[model samples]
Target: MRPTDIESLIGVGRPAISSDGAFAVFASSRPDLAADRTVGQLWRVDLAAGTPRRLTRGVHDRSPRLSPDDAVVAFLREDARGRAQIFVVDAGGGEPVQVTDQPGGVTDLAFSPEGGRLAFSARVPEPGRYGTVEGRDAAAEPPRRITGIRWHANGLGYLDRPAQLFVVDVPATDAEPFYPPAPALDEPRARVVAGPATQLTHGDADWSGVAWTADGAELLSVPDEIESRRRDLRDRVVAIAVDGGAQREVLGTTENLSIASVDVAPDGTVFALANDVGEGGVDFVAPGVALFAVEADGPRALTDAETIDLGEVGSHLTFDGDQVLVQDRARGRVRLLRVTRTGAVSEVLGGDLEVNGHAAAAGRVVASVASPESFGELVMVHGREMRALTSFGATARERGVVVPVEREVTGRDGYPVHGWVAVPEGEGPFPVVLQIHGGPYAAYGVHLFDETQVLVDAGYAVLYANPRGSAGYGRAHGRSIRGRMGTLDFADVMDFFDAVVADDPRLDGDRAGVMGGSYGGYLTAWIIAHDHRFAGAIVERGFLDPAAFPGSSDIGSFFGQEYVGTDPARIAAQSPMAVVDRVRTPTLVLHSERDLRCPLDQATRYYAALKSGGVEAEMLIFPGEDHELTRAGRPQHRVQRFDAVLEWWSRHLPVG
Candidate 1:
């Protein structure tokens, strides 16, 4: 599909299934709604009648969870700063009660089983210790100064606060500035009650997907080991006590499983979709949407499917009182599977099930389906009758256009490098945009356009390839660029470009340009430094100097240790800064000012070096944005980002 076509079919929002299976909620960016932009709102679909009704008029609501009694729907709403806040609206749709007012916002909310409380994740507030906290909050009897001497040690240097979890009363709707009493070393006590927030699995490790036990006394969370020792580290599920006690490793590392989507069965069976790389590499690894029951022994894998990889993002295994609902990624669609304890997964419903949330509730089964072309609908599984319960058009639009064409490029080692040739809908021999993806570990799967589509629509031939060090294919291919970043990865692109031109003479390789964010951005910088194949390039939020990142970025140590080995010297060797002097391409260094991952200094150094060497280069900084530049920036800012990229590419690779 062309970028404009992809934009037009920005399909349904992610559907979420409520606890009771009575309602399903999802978001859509339908042009039929307010603006053509993505507006995430909550919707309730009746599982019995299969009728979906829009609830919560808030424009950008997401991640809806139904209360146990089905009376309330708790969701996240974007505030002024675009930080998501937890909001609660009635099932019938009413004024949303803002539950969380934290600075960073809340995500993945779970209502207490008794329905009297809510547990969610929020960035620990770092209210800076400024002037004496005198008359600020009326919630405090006598407004007092909030101070922390060692807040900086915890990375709260800018703020006079510490990182922690907070629990307020259920409908804590009253906007009151209440600062908890600071912890005194003499009588140190955590402000966030462990029992309330379930501080299981301590450390600064980022935690997500918290699911409460049946009794609500415990919780389940999947946390990625943020240390970053491996390229593709898999997350594991752990059980934590609500009382902030010890955590149990319910899952093991042997599985090499990154639990993508998880659902707890009615009988407490935890079903998860995993990229089982246990049998050596991802190629030999079975791509499984397996059913595992948590036992005293550990997780017992049950699904018998072999090699069929489940779509990690949209795929989930929701347990009905009797069966489980899952989206069949192997089939490029969603399916309703009824799995018995005997390990039989029955296909109850088939075809493309388009809905957003696991947001359907009924007696035994809950269903949701989503499509890139339409708004996801709540599906009802009643005695073999499957139907959509809601109507939501796809949210988010695409301004770029692209046509996917497969091309095989030979790498430096004579290995075939696979890629897709995405040409915007226009005239012949378009100026090429050599777009690289991040992850140096992730893949540019299938044909979905978000940012690059815009570039193609701007009349550019885009080349996206898996040059090695990318996942999905296998470990050998995934690890090929471990120590040879610019070497093999760069060759993969060169080969892919040559093959694309060889296969299609219409591609104008002479006017080719390059751009990428993160690792891809790193490659763009490396490409300009190593070769002059591209006319111009935009290095978005890239890591120019690996040496500087370790001290600043949260996972600095990991990035250096894993990819380049445990030596800082080795990291410097593979980093783009090591060869910045050779760059000749007109490069636009774009970065976020507050990016915690790559940091802005990388861009600053690259820009400074390029200008110092008289290289044609410019730098654009997005304030208040982290690693994500265009994805999370303000709408106007995002548009400007596309404009800047197009302008840069247009200046170099003039389309005619």
Candidate 2:
């Protein structure tokens, strides 16, 4: 696919299945070339008939959720002022009604068990004279007092506001709609119809993944209690009563594991995806599905030591009767697996395609699936049968797409590395670009990646692999590079590249380039510093100095302690900046101005050092963007990023 094809690509998000498994609703985005932006809308699909239909047409809508009774679907949409407010529409089809009016936008939301209330998490401004100001005023007026270590996030920007849970009562009838009919066709039609929302949780800690109990009397959530200054604080599961009583911890105090997501079963069994702390460190712990009983001794891991790794990016867990339905990553594909209370794991639906998000009900699963040729579409799973619900990427597939061929390379340490190689249509000894994935813990699976496809379209062979530190292989494979970031993991990357080059004579080793973001960015920087086989390198939001990173990044204070250790000397040694003087490859650095994860300073420091050493280097900073620039950035910006990569590679690794 061409780089411009990004605008036409339809992207799908999380899906919500009705309680009776009759229908499902999900959020999807398609390019609006007229507006020079992508517009998000909610879509519904019938499970029995397998027909997809658009439900709501909004500028930006997401987080579609079905109420318990499946009468209405609640979703978040941006108002004219850009604040994300919760809106509800009939499950069958109708105009959406606004439910909340929070100054700050609502994020993760959930419906009450009885479908009478909606609980949502939103960022509320700090108590001050200028606190209530929102939209353009809040952006223009910014002279804030920084008080805490975790004050800024990569995409969301300054954490000056606190995220809290709010609940609003839904109306029993729609005789008088929350909003009146629009006078003009283009005017917004959402009006606040629900009662004034009551604040549920308070304080500086951020609460998310709100889930209601089976009885509809209480809510369970994972709250990051920032009691200490250390960035390595672990979040705990807490129960908040519907009556607004004091919240109580469902799990006992133990900082060993960092809880990611939480869900409560009908029998009061709490299930979570968590990373168990080991001697290696906390940040590198491979997340696994676990079950927690309020009366049992403690949480018991359900998928521990298994080959399947929980999809931590956007995966969720829910109870299907006594079985816990989980979406996880195996090899390069995200699949749905059923885990019983006795630790028995079995595949329900998934193979070849990547399941982005899913919701289960009445022994049926509705998920958004994507592949190497398709972007993302909705699918339904019942028993052993799976059927397509949407065909959004039919045009792209018809235009001829480059499908990656999977290859397994033996690492220097005797471990097998999984990767994909995608070649252009017509080529001979073509320039190759080695693409690395971020999260250091995440894997590049059998999914359609825009970045990889763009490179292939530009007449470049793209090679992406899951090295030693990547998940989906096993727990040991993921934790192999915990303390030794640049040692074994780096070796695995080089080994995989060497094996691919030796086997494929069409790939030009002399005209090779490397690029990656986040953890992948870190590896690209590290690879160039240690070895100069690559002619060009692109580092996007990478960490160079571990010592400085722990202080400047959002997860800085604790990430270093977990990955590199407490020793200052060892941390410095593992950083790419330590060996900058030995680097000779031309490099391009890209970073977002508002990126708090790796921060802008990390890029600036590396660029300055490269220039000082008389090395060819260029730095580009995206304004008002964050670490998720490539994945969820503005449409135009994403095109520009791909263009920049192609331009850089052409200039440095030109193929004549």
- The lowest-lDDT stretch of 10 consecutive residues in candidate 2 is 127-136
Which tens-of-lDDT digit does each residue in 166-256 have in candidate 1?
Answer: 3334663333423466767787553321123333444544566666677776667776533323334556787767775557777876666
How many clashes show up per model? 48, 3
Cα RMSD, model 2: 3.4
Off by over 4 Å in 1: 1-13, 18-23, 29-39, 46-52, 78-85, 98-104, 114-116, 123-209, 221-263, 270-293, 300-317, 320-403, 406-416, 567-573
Off by over 4 Å in 2: 31-36, 128-131, 134-147, 178-191, 278-284, 287-296
lDDT digits (tens) for residues 82-133 of candidate 2: 7889988888888788888877788878888778899888888775423464
Q: Which candidate is the best by TM-score?
A: 2
TM-score of 2: 0.93
TM-score for each predicted model, relative to the true structure: 0.73, 0.93
